[model samples]
Target: MPTPSYPPKPSPGDRIAVVSPSSGLPGLFPRPYELGLARLREEFGLEPVEYPATRRMGATPQERADDLHAAFADPEVKAVVASIGGDDQITVLPLLDRELLRSCPKPFFGWSDNTNLLAFLYDCGVVGYHGGSVMCELGRPGAMHPMTAESLRAALFTSGPYELRPAERWNDVDRDWADPATFESEPRSRPGGGWSWINADRVVEGRSWGGNLEILSWLLMADRAIARDESAYDGGVLILETSEELPGATEVFRILRCMGERGLLRRFPALLTARAKSWSFERPNNPQQAARYAADQRAAVERALRAYAPDTMAVFDVDFGHTDPQLVIPYGGTVRVDGPARRITVTY
Candidate 1:
């Protein structure tokens, strides 16, 4: 595969396309959608353009593909952002015009189900961002988390090596997006525990890959974004995070074991496991329960790494998943993991 290329950065006043390539929850929850768009204009100083299918629930894969094509093909739209992620983006991937996206590559920002598109773009040799959705992070109720906003600004406008910092305080519990009161204040948070590291003695640099674990598992089962040759991931940084669905430790192990069986785990020399999301609306875990959940999830990851790629350096709880104050990671772009120095830097 050819080395991936970085898309040109957009200026402050440039237009950005906001599309719903997965779910059109924007129609049901216009509050976050409107707030996100408003932030793009007021906070980020960029105009956000939406497509017809953006807010239309139950949009077909073909319709979603059309929105993606239109967003990337328009020269005026400097960047493409997902309104929010949904479960069915994997269905939309096969319908995309690879040639069109490759020819007119632009910075794409999204996470969760948008992992499908990010991985697809990686295969096409274009680096797409792995965080920064309009609704969840940008339209984040009260205001954009300070760290999230700062990191996003840097990723959008600048081109350089940006060091990532662990969040001082983080929240995994979500407030009701429908409740007007949810937008009045920031979500409750707890003091953040620092990152956990294993085999932390060397500095490794490579192209970044991986996203929501569940999404990647689906892609692997379908044999979609995964390269047939496992060697394609050699020297790549594998960054993964679980979703609010909260897959158990056993399930996590099974997925990594499958990746190991495919000869994928051994290819990457480094991994960044995102902070596991332990709380959800259905299972509102207390602080202690949440901690235990995170601990168990970390143990599962370590077990898999020890069995498959013992020498691969690992870092856990880097706060780039379902956690609040998420940072944007560059998919298929450069990531430098400095273990001894306890630092991580990604090329924007």
Candidate 2:
């Protein structure tokens, strides 16, 4: 793989594309979408430009690809942001015009299903951001989390190393977007105990890789953007997080085991696992249940690593992925994991 470079960052007045490369939850939940757009303009001072398929749910794969092409190919659009995530973005991968995106690269920010595009862009030799979806982060109910806002501000306009910090208070429970009352207050959170490190004897710095665990499994099964040469990931820091779907512990272990079988797990010297999302409307477990859920997931990860990459350094409960107060992780960009100092930094 060629060295991936960061795309030019967007300026305050620049027009940034807001496309739903996955799902158009914007149409259904206009409250958060509009709030997010307002924050983009008022708080971030950037103009958000939406495409035709952005608000149209069930848009075909070709239509989504066209929007991606238009956004990346347009010189006026300095960046691309996803409105929200969906389940089937993998379908749009093959339809994408790699040459077009490669020739006209721009910073793209999103997570979850957007992992597909971020992975694709990384393969195209362009670094893409792996957090800050419009509806979820920017449109967060009440005020944006202070840590999240500060981190995003630095990422959007700055070009230097920014350290990642654990949220003082973090939340995994989500409010009902369908209820207007949900937007009336901030999501409740509990005190964060900070990151837990495993095998923190040395520092590791390398290009970052990985995203939503479930989506990556899909990509691996389809033989998509993952590098054909296992050596491509040598020395890279692996980032993994589960989604709102909350796959079982056994499933998570099985997925990583498969990656290890393919010789992909042992290459990374360090790993950063996003704080596990423990709550969802479909399976709303109580506090005790949620705690057990997270513990089980962590145990599952440890089991897989013991069987494969036992030497790798692992950090758990870093604030990113499906949790509130998400941090923007650069896909294919350089990351510095200082285990001895207990610090993590990424270049934008």
Candidate 3:
């Protein structure tokens, strides 16, 4: 595939489309959604314009696709951001008018289920951002994470190479958005264990691909947004992260195993696995359990890569997805993974 082109960055006062391509949780829980919008205006100095389906629950796939089409087609909307990610965005992919998006080519920011759109945009030859959902990162309960804010601002305004730094402290814990206390202060965070590296001898520079692991599994199963030939991904940086619905180590290994079986694992020489999200409302794991969870996840990744792509350089706990102080990663854009230098840089 050809190198995808990035759309122009949005100016501070420019209007940005905020759409819900997946779930309309914004309507159900407006607290974080509203707070996210406020921050977009106050912190980023950008105006967020919402489409009809942005907050509409049970919106049809066509309706969601329409919102995306409108967002990209609108001349005034410089960028498009997802309100949040959901489970069923793959269904909306077929409803999208590819020609419309191909022509308009606006910058899109999202992760998780939004991986569907990011992969779609990549196939369409337009670069999209893999992180920065409004509800999760922007609508963060208390204040925006300093690292997240800085990474987001750079991705939004700048158009150059940006180096990613490991978060000194990161949080995987969650707060009840409905509870007023959640917004009172920052969520407690633990000291970062730091990134774990395997095969740290070389540097690899290439375009980026991949997203939430479970979502990518679904995409691979459905054969959506994936290139017809696995070779299309050769030299691309593979980024993978687990969501709040944390899949166990065995499950993680199974997904990667499938990718390997399909000849996908050998295509990329560098991999960036995100910090595992161990705690959720449904399963409130203590710090000890969280530590074990992350350790197991790391081992699972190593096992998969060892079996499939033994020489691939891999880094874990990089804090890019489903974790606090998340960094922004460019999908279909350039990423340089320097294992020898212990540095990762992305071209926005």
Candidate 4:
């Protein structure tokens, strides 16, 4: 197994390339995209440079791949971030230049479908960030969540262990990006339930792995980017989260069952399950429905663990994915899960 190395951190004044590898949501919803870029500059002190397909709708996979190549190869671009996530980034994976990306390693920030690229970077021995997309995190409704901003700041600029705190308040309901009123104020968030632990009797520290649960299922089905040898991921922390699509509990368990069947579940000593996103524009789930969905999903996860890696320490309702006030998880970087101490820390 190849050890993943942390890429160079970008200073405040450095140039960061923003590309739309998945969807060109920026083109469709300019308000949030522009707002996110402005925050990148005004708040973070970093200049955002957009690529050719960044704001273009329906761009070809090759075009998106080219933008990624250009961003990583550019000496002036300190890091690369996705404008937003889309469903078809899997198509762009084959077109990427493996050698070029490996040679000019830089921090790439994204999640959801961006899991494809993050997995690829991991295979190439580079660490990638699992959260901090420009539109979602940076352009968040009215203002960035303080916890989110702080975590991203450390992940972007620092090179050490950063503690992960459960969100004081978190929300998964998304507003209409097209509506002007959506950005008028912060998204409505509810009191956090804090993290739930299972079999958390020991501490486990390992390089992080995993991403969007559905995206991971896609990667597994396609047999792309995943380590050919299961041992490659041995001892790595599995970081997983559901997206706004809000898959059913049965679907979640089936996917984990498949992984377990392939002898993949026992590799990880610890698992970090992000808070399930139970609401979507299409579903418009009521509060009761949302709670039921999350509960079912958690039950399915617990069943899988009991059947496969029963002793694997597990934590749920973590604010690391899809939820408001998301924390950045370093893909292929170090994650220390101290069950006894009730603390989670990641190497940025």
lDDT of each: 0.93, 0.93, 0.93, 0.94
* TM-score for each model: 0.99, 0.99, 0.99, 0.99
Where's the lowest-lDDT run of ten residues in candidate 4?
Answer: 223-232
Clashes by residue pair, model 1: none
* Model 1: per-residue Cα lDDT over 32-107, one tens digit each: 8899999999999999999989999999999999999999999999999999998999999899998999999999
**Candidate 1, residue 248: lDDT:** 93
Candidate 2: count the clashes.
Answer: 0
Q: Give per-residue lDDT, candidate 3, residue 165.
A: 90
Best by lDDT: 4
lDDT of 3 by residue, 211-328 (tens): 9999999999998988876687999999999999989999999999999998899999999999899999998998899889888998999999989999999988898999999999
RMSD (Å) per prediction: 0.7, 0.7, 0.9, 0.7
Give candidate 1 misplaced runs (Cα > 4 Å).
none
Residue 259 accuracy (lDDT) in model 3: 93
Instruction: State the weakest 10-residue window (summed lDDT) of model 3.
Output: 1-10
